[model samples]
Target: MHVPDGFINAPVSAAAGVVAAGAVAVSLRGARKELDERTAPLAGLVAAFVFAVQMLNFPVAAGTSGHLLGGALAAILVGPYTGVLCIAVVLLMQGVLFADGGLTALGVNITDMAVVTVVVAYALFRGLVLVLPRKRGSVTVASFVAALVSVPAAAIAFTAIYAIGGTTDVPLGKVFTAMAGVHVLIGIGEAVITMLTVGAVIAVRPDLVHGARGLSAPLKLRVNGELVDAAPAAAPAATPVAARSPKKIWISGVVTALLLAGFVSFYASASPDGLEKVAADQGIDAKAEPHAAADSPLADYGVKDISDARLSGGLAGVIGVGATLAVGSGAFWAVRRRRHTDAGARA
Candidate 1:
């Protein structure tokens, strides 16, 4: 849920912004280590896919809607640090260009949505995967559980922040209850979407999935009456052929994201999302300020001067996908290039 400009006081918002900036800086370094031949390239696609799916806000309750927060999905598909970067990119795009989230509250949004969600979900996922069977299904299950919990965790984080610098005089306890209850429902939707997407990706190319890496069981052999780990096979000559066709996956993923944003989003619920609903009920947004970029050409996810609702929205969605993909991919590519350059220099 995007906090508007004045949801939190200036001091808290600025502090949150500092936190978000630090998290992004840390993630940039971590992503260099996480992104390899496969994951590095897929990082951009992960961000783009997240940005697109987030546009499809499905109804969760009577008047509350939820969408893919993308923390668990990205962490499961890629890695946690990269996941943070992906989400941060989406938040940046939404705030700066679409004016969906307030620019002043960018730090708050990033801290709650990007940092907290990614950290909590990935931790849960890793813990569950460790206990469960080392199978693709286990990964999916872990992803579901992780995503299910992450949403409420984010809601709680918001509540805590509001308690510190809320613009209204609402009781913190009441605010907590409402935020927790509604976000739990939203979390279920997040879990389902995350499970399906992660399952789909793992089914197609498990090797390409960063979270699934190193999870395959080693081969074993029965020697007489005892089972023993099989001897390692000699390495095959390095072939020039593509191990996995990343280009194909990238194109397919981009096309799918475009379709979801450009077409499927038209069917999204027209209700306020969980955060907005809760804020209204709790009076947390009594002092909410209008976004500074409300007059942007693509404000509110619609094209400027477009009277046709569907066309304007659809065009905006497509533009968002394109812009997010370009920026996210470019950032990831730069990181990847730096990693390669550093390696070469060391060599």
Candidate 2:
């Protein structure tokens, strides 16, 4: 959920901004380790996919709705560090391009939505995976539980932010209860989507999944009567052919993102999302100013002159998907390039 400009006061917002900046800085350094050829492509795809899937809002309560937070899903699919980077990129694009989230509240949104959710959910996911069975099924189960918990955790984070920097006289208790209640329902939807998506990727190319590393069992051999696990072998060297085919996965992922955002978003519910509804009901929106970029031609996901609601939204979604892919791909590729350079230097 995006925290708009008016919800949090300047001081608190600025502080959150500092925290968010520090988080991004740390993630940038950490992501270099996670952004090899296999994961760099997937990281960009994760951002584009998160952008696309966020269009479909599921009803959380009678009036409020929620969309994919994407933290748990991304963390599970990629790794925790890269997952933070992916969601950060999506938030950056949505704020600047669509004005979906406020620029002033960028830090609030990233800290609450991107950082907290990714860190909390991923930690829980790893812990559960460690305690649970070692099968692939356990991975999906842990993902489900982790995602389910992460949404309300994000809602709680919002309430705390509001408590610190709320612009209105709304009761903190009410805000917490309402937000937590609604987001809990939303968490169910998040869990299902996160598990399904994670499960799909894990099924097809488990090796490509960052979290799946070290989970593969060795080939088994029978010696006489006793059975033993075969010794693990070194991974094959990267081939030039493999490098070219990497583009294919990126292409396919971008196409899927385009279809989801550009066309499918038209069917999205017209109701306001979680933060908007909460602000309206709680009267925390009094000081909320219109977005600085609200006047942008592409503001509110509409073309400047488009009349048809469906067509305007569709075009905006397409533009968003394209921009997200380009920006996200460039970011991850740069990280990967730096990693390669570092490796060569070490050699």
Candidate 3:
């Protein structure tokens, strides 16, 4: 959920800002290990994809809707550290460009949505993958469970933060109950989206899916009436020209993201999302302040002075996808460059 300004006090918000900064710093270092030639570009694509999918909010309850949080999906496709950065990029873009989230409360949103969700989902996903059969399907299953849990975990995190710095005097129990309850329903949608996205990527390019790496069991051979592990296969003398290029998958992913955001987003549910609904019902928005960028041309996911709702929204969505891709790719490529620099220095 995107926490708007005025929901949390200045002190707590600043504290959360420090925490967010520290987490991002740590992720930048950690992402060095996760990013390279193959994954660095895909990381940006994953961010754009998440941004696109989040535009399509699905109905969860009669008046409540939910959208992909993208932590589990991103973490499964890329890696945990990169996943956090992906979400941070999306949140930043939404806040500054679309006025979807508040600028003052950026830290709170990053902490609750980006850091908490990625940490919880990736940890749970790895744990589940360890215990389950080491198969492609198991990665999909783990992605589902990890995503399902991450939504409520983020809700709990929000409730805890609100208890400490909530602007209103709403009862803590009511806030917790409402946030947790609605988000559980929302979690199912998150699970399904994460599962399908991870499954699709693993099917096409398991090597590109960080969570699915090493999932294929070692080849076995029958010898002396018993199956034995086959000797490791030697590396091929020459890499297949077709196998070396992820251009096809990358192009396909970009096209899919464009379609989802540019056109399909128009059909998404118009109802308020889980957090907005809970805030309105629980009186959590009593002190909510207007977004600083409310007057931006692209504010509210529509182009300024555009009378046609469909065209304005479509253009805004396209712009958002493009901006996110650009910013995210730049950030990830920098990280990748730093990784190579470090290696060169060491050598």
Candidate 4:
């Protein structure tokens, strides 16, 4: 959930900001190893995809609605380090461009949504994948479970953050219960979306998915008591291999993101999300300062003058996807560049 301003006091928000900055700094260094040649470009696509899917909030429980947090999905698609960076990129874009999350509370949001979700989800994902049967289906199963847990984990994280920085006098126990309960329902939605998206990507290009990398058992030939790798057979000279094209996948992902953001978002339940409703109902919203960018043209995820919800939402979603992709790509490219420089020095 995107934490708006005022839920946390200035001091706690500032402390969380420092923590968030440190985490981002660490992720940038770690991403150098994670976002390699093949996956660097895909990292941006993953962020854009996350930005898109987040727009389609599915109703859960009586009135609460949930959307993809994207930590598990991104980590499964790319690497965990890069995944955190990708989500960080999306949150930054949403906060600054769309006035969706609070600028003052940016650190809290990033720490809870990006750092906590990615770390916790990816850990569970790896543990399950390691123990499960070695098959492609296992990857999808692990993704679903990882995503399922991640949402609640994020809720818990936010609750804890609120406990520390909360400006109001609301009981911490109630806040924890409400946040966790609603988010558990949200977790189901997260699981489905994560499984479907991960399954779709795996179907087309398992190679591009970081988590699916070792799931495919190697082709082998039994020799004595051991198995040896099988030599790849040569293709016939006359047979032409299809050109590898990420263009199709990228275009499809972008289009899917657009549809989800622009049109689907309008139909998404108007009920306050798990976080928003909790803030208001639990008295956490008392201190919420108006978003710094409330006056921005794209504030509230709609065009200022646009009356049609569909058109306004669609334009906002499209812009979000484009901006996320651009920003994510630039961040990943810089990381890749540093990696190359380091490798060159080592060589």
What is the lDDT of every predicted structure here?
A: 0.91, 0.87, 0.94, 0.89
**TM-score for all predictions?**
0.96, 0.92, 0.97, 0.93
Candidate 4 lowest-lDDT run of ten = 236-245
Task: Look at candidate 1 and tell me the lDDT of residue 14.
Answer: 96
Of the candidates numbered 1 and 4, which has the greater TM-score value? 1
Order of models, best lDDT first: 3, 1, 4, 2
* Per-residue lDDT over 177-277 for candidate 1, one digit per residue giving the tens place of the 0 to 100 score: 99999899999999999999899988888988877877877778999989899988898888555545777788899999999889898899999998899
- Model 4 stretches astray by more than 4 angstroms: 218-242
lDDT of 4 at 2: 97
* RMSD in Å for all candidates: 1.8, 2.7, 1.6, 2.2
lDDT of 4 at 9: 88
lDDT of 2 by residue, 1-347 (tens): 89888889899999999999999989988999888877888898999999999988877677677899999998888888889889999999999988888899999999988999999999999998888866788889999999999999999999999988899999899899878888888999999999998888777667676666676567889999888999878978776875545566667778888888888888877787777787788787888878878988888888889999888988998988888888988999998898888889999
Q: For residues 1-347, could you state the per-residue lDDT of candidate 3 as single tens digits? A: 88999999988999999999998999999999999999999999999999999999999999999998898888888899999999999999999999998898999999999999999999999999999998999999999999999999999999999999999999999999999999999999999999998899888888899998877788989999999999989977987878767888888999999999999999999999999999999899999999999999999999999999999999999999999999999999999999999999999
Locate the minimum summed-lDDT window of 10 residues in model 2: 242-251
Greater lDDT among 1 and 2 belongs to 1
Give residue 176's lDDT in candidate 3 (0 to 100): 92
Which ranges of candidate 1 are over 4 A from the true structure? 222-226, 232-243
Model 3: residue 154 alpha-carbon error in angstroms: 0.4
Greater lDDT among 1 and 4 belongs to 1
In terms of lDDT, the best-performing candidate is 3
